[model samples]
Structure formats: structure tokens, C-alpha cells
Target: MTESTTFNFIDSARRTVKLEQEAVGLLSTHLDDNFTRACQMIIQCRGRVVVTGMGKSGHVGNKMAATLASTGTPAFFVHPGEASHGDMGMITPGDVVIALSNSGETSEVTSLLPLLKRQGTQLISMTGNKESTLAKAADSHLYAGVDQEACPLDLAPTSSTTCALVMGDALAIALLEAKGFTAEDFAFSHPGGSLGRRLLLKVENIMHSGDQIPVVSPDTSLPEALLVATSKGLGLTTVADADGKLAGIFTDGDLRRAIDQGVDIRNASIKDVMTAGCKTTSPGMLAAEALKVMEDGKINALVVQDEGRTVGVINMHDMLRAGVI
Candidate 1:
């Protein structure tokens, strides 16, 4: 593409982002008692937050529901048209309803207003127009009004959707703080994510144990220890005493140092060449913590211990293969 054409596209993208950012920036001033009341309603909700909308608002509502659900607030989305077709059963009197409609007059959403009111479910409407029918019927309303759409035709839901999504996020975060939601709690909701893996995957879960662990007695010959390390493919072997208590560690680095010192690998005992005071980690500790210890010590492997006895071994390669990085 021509440089001028590329520059024009870049400039257009920047202008759109700037317009949406301005819409988001203006939302702070709109926060009032209604926002607080909405938070209170969600906080007190004994049931899930049922989000409902139509068209593009429905898409935004789905994302808002997911965000809320993942961040400690129990929530789910119900299409307004589906709600009219018996999906309203998903909502109960103890539930709080978050209705999104930019124009505040979407027929599909507004048509369910009377049924929702009859069920005594609290309604929190997010809309651009306070005077719209949906806003008028809500128990509380959050105005996500923007000056203009980012779309040149002023037709697509651009800045208005961004504002609505941000407002939803504000409500979810405010309720999360009010309820004292924590990272651990969030991890429970996202157990398959990287954060959950870092927080929950213990060293014991991934470390090589039993026959897979590379270990040699302190009196073992250097060549025998090398055999163990090679068989286990950990680039290192743990040296233990007669009682099976950890004594030290033998690594490729130690082997290289031994060779440089002209130590006879065929006749030397592992204790003579192994590095003393080896770094160790507990099995109960997180793999992330073990990874940190390896990084801080500038080492590639660690002995996994439990009750002062070496039970397993884990190397940097194991961690990488296990997605601990």
C-alpha cells in the first residue's frame, strides 16, 4: 500500500480509538448514587445477575455477564427474545436484572419489563437515554450516554457500546471490591487459565518422582551418578546418604568442573564432585515459586523435598514442558 494510504488508515484508527476513549473518560462524572445503588442491588442479589439485551447490545450483555461471573459476581445472559419465549424462568425474585439498550426503547427488552416487575426482580438499566421507556421502568438506571458514535454514519454501535461495556465493568468491579473478592477466588472461576496454573499447580504435581527421579548415594561412583542423570535426562542427580537423606546435588556443571580439575570420573565418589548445600524446594510449594527459586539461584534444576527428604527432582526443562513458564 502507498505510504499516504497507510497513514490515512492509521490516522482513522487513532481517531476512532480517541473518540471511544473520550466516551469512557466522561463516564467517571456520570457515576452517582444510582451507580452505588446498582452495586448494592448486585451485592445483595441472592441469585445470579441476569443480563438481557437485543442485537449488538445482546453481544455486549453476553460479555458483561461473563466478566461479572468470572470476577466473583454470579451472572448469565438471557436473550430478550428468548426470555419472552420462556427463558425468563432463569430469573427469580432474588436475582438482579441488568438490561442494556442504547436507545432505551428496544422492544424485545422492553416487552419483558412487566413480567420482570411482576416477579419482583430488581432491574438495573444501562442506556444512553434516561427518558427512554426501558430506563423509565427500571428500578435503577446507569446512563452510558456518549456525545456521538465513532462510526462516520452515526449508525453503528461504536462509542455507545464501548461506554456500555465500561459501565458494566465498573459495576462488576465495584461489586467485586464491596464483596472482598480476591485473586484466589478469581482463580477458582478460571482454573484453566495461566494465572490459575501458576497459583495452583504445585511442584509435586509436575516433578519427577520414584523411578523417574535421578538419584545416587553419596558413595556412588561419579560414572554411576552420570548414568543415573543420563537415564533420567534431568542433566542432574541428587546425592543422598545411606539413610536416604539428601546430601548434595551433582549436575552437568559439577561434572565439567570435575573434568577440568582432572578428577577421575571412573574412580571418584559422587560426594567428592557434587555441589554441597544444594538448593531445594518443598513439594507443596507452587511450581511458579520453584521456578522463581531456580531463576534467583541461576540454576536449572532443584530437588523436591518433603519432611527433609528428597522425594523428586524438577528441572527448568520440565517446568517449560509443563507450561509453568
Candidate 2:
């Protein structure tokens, strides 16, 4: 009878999450002047931000570097063990070093402090041990201290690592905003990522322009319009006026509806069977936004217009191909 509730696995997970949450919540209080000082040092540096750490702290350092680099602050991770070898040559003057150490006593990380200091490089320390040697030696020290670990044994780097990661994010985002980092600037760094595509992929990049745009005159026969639509493979054709301005649009659905009402497809005028005032988009519109328009309007295609004249056509398949879907 007692074995049913002897060990509660769910309670264990809940306790770990609650402890870690409280740990992260406390980090905000310490985002004081020291944090700003760290950000300033990084911003003023002519060279890149070099992050270094050993063991679990090293894993956190790698992520910190990636976050910083992606958010407009140039940064990269350096393994402390390798710093003693030829890898240390990568560090040059004007570069700032952000060292991570839980105990502040990691020999591999501490060994390079004197060498980096000699180069007149600024050193920023992220450590749980603010009183440790590495902390006292740095120009700025960020306290990543936690009262207790989320780990049951208090041995693993649980709450401490989470604190480091969040601190890194706060630093990066603050710098990004300070530098007036726009979406276009972010796209430059992430040219192949989904965020880059959403911000930079324009309708014209994936649209059918020139001869690829299916067009039919207002007086063209419905059969001829159907041929233009099918031949272009867009399932629709724009009906233009004498001046090449868009008059209306004829889609496959219009053909089916006209046929159902016995409006002879072989002889009906295109203007009589077309839907006027079709929805249009500009070539400069983001393809992702165009996808939203297509979804909102319940239509699959949009005509690209500039000053009331047709420029091109963009459809759902184009969005899909451009990874905007």
C-alpha cells in the first residue's frame, strides 16, 4: 500500500524547476553598474569579444559567444585548455576577454589571465566566486552566484549555468539595442536563418514578372483566357486595359462558376466573367507578410502593382519555395 507513493518522480522535477526559476529571478537584482561596465568594455573594443572557460563553464561560454555574435556584438569562444597551446595566439590587442569560472580557481583559465593582462586587454569575469582569484584580477566581475544548486546533490552546475546563460542574453540584447541594431542589421548576420528570410525575403525575389505574368485583354474570349492561365501555370490571369493597367482577374474558380451557369466558356468576354479589384501587393513587401495576406484573404495569389500598373504576380507556391511558408 505504501509503495504506490513512496517515490514521487513528478515532485522531483517540479522542485528542480522551481529552484531554477527562483535562481533566474534573483539575477535581475545584480544587473547593476557592473553589468553596464561589462557591456561598455565590449562595445568599445576594436577587436572581438573572446570568451573562455573550462569544464561546464566552458559549455556555457560557447553558448554565450554564439548569442553575443548573433545579436551584433562580435564574439567567439576559446577553450581554456587550448589557450595554453597555440590557440592563445588568436587573442590580439583591443580584444576583451570574458572568463567563466564557477569556483574562480580553474587553473587552466587563471593561467592565461596574466598573459592577457600584459597585452593591455580588458578582462571581464563571470563567476560564482566573486572573492576568488580570477574575480579579483579582472577589470569587471559579474556575479553568477546561486544560494543553492537545482541538483539534488548540489554538485552539478544547474542554477549557476542558467544564471550565466541569462546574464549573457541580457548583455547581448542591451548592446544590440544600444547600437541601434535593426532587423536589416540582424539579417546580415543570419542570412541563412529563418529570421533572416522573414526580414529580407521580398515578394519580387519570388514573383513571376515580365512574360511569366499571364495577362489577357478585357475583350479576350474566356477560352483564350483559360489558355493564358493554364499555359502560365499560375491558375489565374490578369485582365489588363488598353494602357496595361489591371482591369480585373480571371481565375480557374471563375471559369467553373461561369460554366455552371451555362455562360459559354468558348465565347464569353473576359471582363464579363472576371473578378474586379483583385487584391494586390507591392514587390517590396516581405514574402512572409504576403503569406499572411494570402491566408487572411483566403486567396492563393496576389498581383504586384506599382502606381496602378501590373508589375508581377506572387502566389503561395512562390512563398513556399522561398521558405516564407
**Best candidate (score: TM-score):** 2
Which residue runs of candidate 2 sit more than 4 Å off their true CA positions?
Answer: 1-6, 193-195, 256-267
lDDT of each: 0.92, 0.91
Q: Write the per-residue lDDT of candidate 2 for residues 1-325, one digit (tens) a residue.
A: 4876788989989999999999999999877788989989998999999999998899999999998898899999999889899888989878999999989989999999889988888999999987999999999999989999999899999999999888888888999999999887888899998888988999889999999999999999988888899999999999999988898998887888898989977779999999999999998888888889989999889999987889999998888788877
Cα lDDT over the full model 1 = 0.92
lDDT of candidate 2? 0.91
Clashes of each: 0, 0
State every prediction's TM-score relative to the real structure: 0.88, 0.91
Clashing pairs in 1: none
The candidate 1 region of ten consecutive residues with least summed lDDT is 2-11
Q: Pick the candidate with the highest lDDT.
A: 1
Candidate 2 RMSD to the real structure:
2.4
CA shift at 65, candidate 1, in angstroms? Answer: 0.8
